[model samples]
Target chain A: MSRKIVRIAVPVLVLLFLYVPILILALYSFTDATQIGAIRSFTLKNYVTLFSTEELRSMIVGTILLALGAALLATILGTLGAIGSFYSRKRTSSAIATVNQIPVINADVVTGFSLCILLVVVFGVSKDSYIPLVVGHVTLCAPFVYLSVIPKLKQMDSSLYEAAMDLGATPAQALFRVVIPQILGGMVSGFSLAVTLSLDDYFIATYTKPATFDTISTYVVNATRGSQTDIKTALWALSTLIFVLVIVIVGVMNFNSGRAQKKEAEKA
Target chain B: MENNQNIIELKHISRTFEDGFRAVSDFNLEVKRGEFVTFLGPSGCGKTTTLRMIAGFDMPTEGEILLNGQDISKLPPNKRPINTVFQRYALFPHMNIFENIAFGLKLKKMPREEIKKKVKKVLELVDLEGFEKRSVSTLSGGQQQRVAIARALVNEPEILLLDEPLGALDLKMRKEMQIELKAMHDELGITFIYVTHDQEEALTMSDKIVVMSEGKIQQIGTPEDIYNEPQNAFVADFIGESNIFNGIMTGTMQARFAGGHFQCVDDVPEGTQITAVVRPEDIELTAPEQGQIRGKVISVIFKGIHYEITVQSGRYEVVIQSTKSAEVGSVVGMKVEPDGIHIMIAENNTNVFPVDMNRNHRLEFNGTELDTSLTQLIKGSRRNEEHELLDENGEVIDPEKIHIIASIEPQDIRMTDDVDDEQVLIEGTISNLIYKGDHYSYVINTDLGQDFIVDDEYLWNMDDRVGLILPLDKMRFQVKK
Candidate 1:
């Protein structure tokens, strides 16, 4: 019992050690209305100032649209790739799997730097365009989607596809009706991963992203660098909203998948 | 099912893989309407290949496949009036039982109401009606198989092809499904082309059995016909346990075997090699003096319903089964009626030429001039190896070129305690003896990996080196036309 308590204690101590400053920042965001050492009372001015600025709203909308679009695309592509490779012969599949892991293996700073050059030099596209932002985000986020989907696809039973084919379905029909539906659990996870990765990606987005494109991450980074104390509380408010929405989506998808699986089991 | 109504006919069908290995060749079969025909063979015997050809999954390299006299070789699987139930019942994991059964019907664009009714009726037929809305992932294996069957049946194809469909099921489940499938066959009256390696399954479920090996049909007949009247030694030995002996023709109706002349029923010409088939059930055991042939009981095994006794006479091991048990050490006499004798030409056709195999496995045909390859080798030798039996050396002889001879009865070869330089045959003991319900198989421990499979009524024990009997009837005409 003492050992169990000790095991729990070390990790908690480490977490507290790391999160103390974040906790302080969160508290300071509400009270940073006046200069330091005064230690003035809490106010919502910083939070209110964020809402009052039209640019903040535009940046949030842009960030949300870019993240959602890239994440959704990457999720579908990764899932299809994973499921496809799962059914294929080992050598061809291994080659494709190697390609899927390339994004993660490449250093993030290097990828951001290289993509910045490619977008501006090769495509000659403007740096601040939403296309560059979405492109950069998808490049950074797709590997996470791939990583999430591959495990689920690997765990799937191959006999199910054979069963479907033997029962009079064409190869194409089997892929859609049997293969895709069976691995949809993986699809939700892959989507979540891509979305989360896209929402958090700033290094790549900041480098090649359009001038007007300030995702939540870039906006916060810029706001902090510029010493704009007004938007600090609003950043917290925004993080909480994103966290809540992600939780709701995850819970709903999980519940939906569970129910569907139960129904399938009963029918089977 | 076999009353001259041909439903599917395979004419001169041959299948050779791209690697140039022939899996099946010149396979011909005519399936009567609604008949349950089984393709039974050991692994790599082209039985599954034959089934696949019928299902349109594979095309024959030569000749045509006709369905009801209409050529259907060019048709794809779905276009053909047939459906296959695979070894693993491929149930759709995503679809419920109702949707799975209805899938084919939906493809046909049948009315929604009609599809629903058909699906419901088929589900009821498979005893899974209430499971229409339940997902496949939740069902037990048997239930899933039924769903697969229902899925195929709902398509209402004229024929059903099952490739070892019960292979994956447990023994008990397999037995149950066999009965269920047989019942389903009767109820539906659709032609079933079932492929299986299990001889018992073939015998039980099939109206006709096609025994195949090495891409060729060994025999095609009813179960009774196959068991009672085997065409060759392979067929006889394959269908049931058999005690085989070789005897030289003493007269047109007589054979000289084991230093005894017995009255035989075959009409082989004088001087030709002959094979004798003795089924175990025909050999009656009796008291030592009263029996026609006397031997010592070497082994005894208890079957669920009968007792199997093995006896050794000189070098021969004869196995006999009876409801009554016999003491292992007792000496017994055995009796076989003249009518129990089966004679055939003692040779098995093989693709392997005699020259390529090891000398220890060599076979002796009466004459060697008939094989073109052998003739060519003999004509080409620089310093000719002696043809030992020839009076004068007209051509070269190579030990590698000699053919491997097959005797009619494995029991005809008598074992010897010592190898005399003049004696070409080797010595061995009864390493393993099996009493099949109908015959006994004895594996001689030649220790050369060339252990011989001999059949006889004499039951022998392990570690006994008995004289090998090369009965006169086991000799064969070396020439092939």
Candidate 2:
């Protein structure tokens, strides 16, 4: 019983350590206070200001668009890489998988700095170009996508593809129809991971972005850099809204997947 | 006429995997149209590999796979005019039964109505006509197996390959499916090639059984022929219960074994040695003086229909199946008729040793040397005690090379826990113990990768470390031809 309590207590403690500050920020966002420490009457004025601000709206839109584009590109490339690695000879596949892990394990600051130098000084790309930012985000996300999809590929019944070909389907049709459908669950989780990573990444975006443009993460970092006056009270409301939106999205997806799993179990 | 009748022919086909393991070697067969052929063997015997070759899943490393006299070996599985029901009924779980059955037809760009008609017809043939919209995952194992069959049959291929299709089913379900599959084969009129390790399944459903072992076809014959007239000891032991013994042919229709001479119908030459096979059910239980062979019952077990009794006499234990039960430890008599004995030339059971002798009047064979003055070089002058090759005049001479041959029957091998200086001893691990109806026959592998088949009444467990005592009297020496 004590061991069971330890198992539950460990995760609970880790979750409290990770999310307590965010919970406090969300709580302050609902108050009528101008600062985090002050507890005042509750109001929606901060949310109203957040939605009405043109700069904040553009930053949110830019962040989402950048995340969507990066996640899409990374997911496509990573899924193909995973499939290629899965069928390649054992030695070659292991070598490629090892190479794919570099970006995932590399220090974020080091990767951002190296990419900045490569894009600006070597490639003659301007620091303000969207190319550098998008490429950087993809580099950060693709390894995660590759990591997720490869396991599902390994877990899949390899004979399903052969069975499809035996049933008169062409090679391409077998891959797309039979192979992809079986591993779609892994692909979806990988895409979500890439998108989430791209949304929160600040160092790469800051290093690679144009001076005139900013994503939500970079904008928030720039606005709140060691100054109380520069940081806006409405930013808390924006953070709270994004957090709630992520929670709802994750909750709905979990519920749908759980139902699908239950239905599959019943079918079997 | 032959081309029309034979739907598929594998000509000199062989398959070697990338790791250099030969799965199937020199496999040649002409499968007649509408024939049911089963490739039966233990696992890793290349039966499934041969079936996969026919289905175009595996291309033979050598030779041609001709379908109606047209080579289709290089063709992919999708392009071949064949379909395979995999070991597990690999139905598409996401699809309903209707969609699963219609998969192959839809791939051919068949019209919706035509595809539906074909699917419905095949489903009805499998006796699952009303399970169209049911999800594949929702169906029981047997029902799913039928859907898989319907999926393959709806395409109307010229031949069908089943790789242990009923392996995943329960015993009862597998038995029922065996009969159903045979009926389906008859109804479809397509050449069906099935691979399975189950001997009963092969005997029950196959029109012809191809027995394979270690990538080579041992024998190909009708079920009855394979069961009764097995061509080799492996075939006899693999197919059904049999009491195989080493017998020496003294004359035509006369053989000596089990410390007695018996009459057999085999036409082996006089003095030729052979292995004989007798079925347990063929043995008759009688009084001690009324039968030819007398023994004491070692064990008895009632097997619902008959009693399986083991009788020990001499070095052999004769297994008998009779309606009358014999008490354990009771004296009994066992008799076998002349027609019950099947004789075949021994291959693996015969030991072959190269001839080598040094100059000190020593005969060297199997890493052992023996002092002997009787040495000759396959028709050269004879060697004397002083290493002198003596011609007819007893003069000192030398021959360039000597040829010698050695042969020993498997049962002549004596396995003991201790080594003796008087016997030629070799250490081997008991690799396999195959119970050929009554007594267990062991295949022992020596350190030099040579296998020795030893038959003894003693039941040695597999992987037992034992010493083989090969007495020199049992070893027959002959000049190499």
Candidate 3:
């Protein structure tokens, strides 16, 4: 009985430790409180300021667009790399797989600093062009996408590609028609991961972005250090909104996957 | 126009992998139009490799493949007018049955209505009518197999290559599909080239069967011809149950085997070394006094349609299949008709196997380390104290890069009854025996799946556990770069 109590108590304590701060901030976001440790009158003024501010709205839009573009590029490169490596000879494929893992396991700061050096110092590409920014994000995300896609390729029946070719489809046609659909699930998860990685990244963005541009992560850090209490409080509302969106998205994903698993079980 | 009947011809086709493992060697076959040709062999016998070469999935390392008298060896699978039904039904899981079947048609850019009509007709051909809208995952294995066949057939390929399409099916479903596929072939008049390890399936379906073993074709003949007239011990053993004995011609129309002299249909020069095959079903049991050879029934098994009896004579165990049952331990005489005996010239009486040179310059074969040196493999080469072999010019020879083949005459290897004897180099079971005039040639199969042929003047009973002693002086080694 005590062992069972420990098990339940431990997990509850850990979860509480993780969510308590976020819950407190969410609760405060709904009020007109200027600071924590004090309760002010209930109001939607923080949310109103969060949406009405032109600077915050543009920065959020710019960050989202950057993430979308980078994730798209990363997904294509990663999927193609995975398919190419999977079809290569054993030695070449394993060598490619090993090389692809280095970026995934390396420190993000190191990756960002090196990209900054390579693009700014060696190649002399202008930082204002946003090429280095997109390249850094793709470098950070593509390896992760490749890692996620390889298992799906391994799970797929390899003969399906040959079957398509035998049925008179060209190699490219077989790849697109038979191979891509089977690995689409892995690609989707990889794309979402790339997007999340791009959004969460701060060092790479800071190193590579233009001096005038600011992502949410950089803006939040700058905003907290500034003396503007209104914008700071508005950030609480933004954080609350992002947290709620994540919860809804995760919930829908779980529901969809559960239904898919149930359908697979029924088919079997 | 006389050559028009041959739709596809493989001339000296060979496929050696990058790692130097030969999958198919010098394979040649002429497949006639509308002919149901089957390549029959055990797994890793180059049957599927040959099929893949014909299907354009694999390219041969040497030789050309002619499709309607035109070389298509370098053509890709899509460019070739051939389709293959894979062993596992490789249906597109994301597509519905209709879309899967119409994939080739869509690639060809056929009209949508015609694609549908063709899909429907092929689906009915495979007995999967009205299954167009069903998703691939919703179908059973057999249903998916039909969909695969329908997908391949809907394109109406000039040649249909089946690589063990029914290998995944259960016995009953396999039997059913065999008949259905044969009927489909007959109705369509399409040339079918099939690869299978199952001999019964080949016999039941094929018009011509190519028996292959170890990347080489052992024999190519009709099913009746393959069964009744096997060309070698491998074919005799693979095609069906047969008692193969190494015999010698004593006189005209007379051969001596299994401790008995019998008249055979084959006429060879007297004293010629030969291997005789007698099928189990062709041997008749008679009273001991009236039989050509007398033996005691060691075991009897009821085999659904016949009783299979194993009779132990002096040094041989003869398998006989008959409708009548025999009591175990009862004496019986076995008589074989003259036409029942198939005579084949004995293959080379030497056992040759590939061996690797170890770091110590010793030879290794089939997990057994032999007391042979790499220096002995090359003439005028000697191993130094550092274990490196040096040639006559004193240049070091890399043992790792060299390929060593060891060959020993059958008579140079002796077998001992003590299986656990440490002095012996290998231990095996006596799988087969043939009496060749003054000596008995035995096929000893080791647990490692290597067969070593040895000839001894002394008689040994079949299935006797024995250890082989290879005399080093009598063993010859060949070194290849």
Candidate 4:
């Protein structure tokens, strides 16, 4: 009985440790407290400021746009890379897999600095253009997409492509009609992962974004370092909103996967 | 050219993989229009490879493929008038049955209404009517197989290639599918090229059967001809149950084997080495005195329709299948009519036996340890410091997985009159002999029932006891992976 208590208590403690700070911030965002030390009466003032402020709104919108664009590009490139490698010869496929692993394991700072150097210094591409920023995020997210897609490709029946060909579909038709649908689930998950990764990234955006524009991550870092009390408190509301959005997304994904599993079991 | 009845012809086709493994070699076949030809062989015997070549999925490395007298060797699969039903029923899981069947029709830009009608008609052909709009995962294995066949047949190709399409089904379902598929073939009258390792399925469904072994065709004939007159020992053993014995022609119409003389129908010259084949069902059991050869019944097994009996006569075990039952341990006489025996000139008169290799890389034959090492079995293979055999890739090969067959030519074996000689490996009685131009070929039957065909220059009397001297240098070993 004591052992069971430890097992339950251990997880409860760990979860509390991880979520207490976020919970405190959310609670404070509802109150008129400018700082965490004191909690005043409840108000919607912080949430109003978070939406009414033009800089914060544009920054959030720009960050989402950047994430969507980068995630789209990353999903395409990564899916193509995975499919090409999956169909290649054994040696070539394994070599490509090994090469794709380096970026996934490498430090984000190194990738950001090297991409900045390659695009902004040697290539002389101006920072005023957001090319380096989008390239940096795509580089960061594409390998992860490839990693997600490889497993789905491996799980799929390898003969489906041949069957399509045997049934009079051309090579491209087979790939688009038969092969793509089988791995579309992985591609979707990979796209979502890329969006999240781009949203959470700070170092790559800081090094690569245009001088005049700012993403949420870069703006948050600058905002936290300033002495603007009102804006700081409003950021709390933004964090709460982001956290709620994440929870909703994760819950929906889990629910969908669970339903899919149940359906599969019923079919069997 | 347009009036030719041959649908597809494979001319001297060979396929060698990148790793130097030859999957098919010098294969040639002409598939007549509307002929239900089956490529029958054990797995990895190039039957599926040949089928793939015909389906335009694989290109032969050496030869051309002709479709209606036009060379289409380099044509893509989509360009060919062929469709294949895969072994695993590779149906699109994301699609409904209607969409799956209408895929090829859609590619051809057929009208939507016509596509639906065609799908409905083909589904009816496969007896899967009213299955449209159902997801693939909701179907049973047999149902999925029917969907696959319907999907292939809806295209109306000139030829349909089926690569063991019923291999995944249970026996009863497979039998049902076999009859249904044959009926479908007859109704459609389309050419069908099938690949299967099951001999019974091949014999039951095919108009022409091509038996293959080790990337080569052994025989191509009708089912009746293949079962009645197999060209080689491989075909004879693979097609059905037969009692094959190493024998020699004693006279114009007589052959001596299995320690007894019997009259055969083959008109081979006297003193010629031959292999006599007698089907199990052709042998009749009788009283000991009224039969050609006598033996004691060792086992009697009741099959569903007949009784299978094994008789041990001298150093031979003859298997006989009959409707009547026989008492085990009772002596009985077995007789084969003159026309029941099928004889062929012996292809290889060498003595070959399976040998095992121990961890120490020593060769073991018939449970007796020999002085030969495992490396001697395969040339270019060497033993490492740990006494494990290393293949050409320097990889340690498992001794148990390698099938080692040691063979000694008839000319390489020496017979000794002294049964207790030190160099003698086995002692046996002289069962049969054939006189060649300058030498004599003898079949020695050991007590373990193994036959050793040896070529000797001197004369040996009948029933004389002799010991075999297998010289170490004269024996050749082959390793089958």
- Best by TM-score, which number? 3
> What is the C-alpha local distance difference test score of each model?
0.72, 0.83, 0.90, 0.89
User: CA shift at B34, candidate 4, in angstroms?
Assistant: 0.4
TM-score of each prediction: 0.75, 0.85, 0.88, 0.84
Per-candidate interface DockQ score: 0.29, 0.56, 0.73, 0.64
| Segments of candidate 2 deviating more than 4 angstroms | A1-19, A31-34, A39-43, A117-128, A226-231, B1-4, B348-481
User: After TM-score superposition, what is the CA distance of residue A107 in candidate 3 from its true location, in Å?
Assistant: 0.8
Per residue, candidate 2 scores C-alpha lDDT tens digits across A150-234 of 9988888777778889999999998888889878888989999999999989888878888888888888877776464314768
What ranges in model 3 sit over 4 Å off?
A: A1-4, B1-4, B352-407, B411-469, B473-481
Q: Which TM-score values does chain B get in all models?
A: 0.73, 0.81, 0.81, 0.76
Which pairs clash in the backbone of model 3? Answer: B246-B434
How many angstroms is residue B381 displaced in model 4 relative to the true structure, after the best TM-score fit? Answer: 31
Which of the predicted structures, 1 or 3, would earn the higher lDDT when compared with the native?
3
Q: Give the TM-score ranking, best first.
A: 3, 2, 4, 1
lDDT of 1 by residue, B125-221 (tens): 8888688788777787888788888888888888888888888889999999999999999999998988998888888888999988768898999
Report interface Cα RMSD per prediction.
3.4, 1.2, 0.7, 0.8
Docking class of 2: medium
Clashing pairs in 2: A128-A210
Query: Which runs of model 4 end up more than 4 angstroms from their true locations?
Result: B1-4, B349-470, B473-481
What is candidate 2's CA lDDT for residue A225? Answer: 68
lDDT of 3 by residue, B288-399 (tens): 9878889999999999999999998887878899999999999999899999999998888798877787676678765567776566558888877887788888888766
Candidate 1 second chain TM: 0.73
Docking class of 1: acceptable
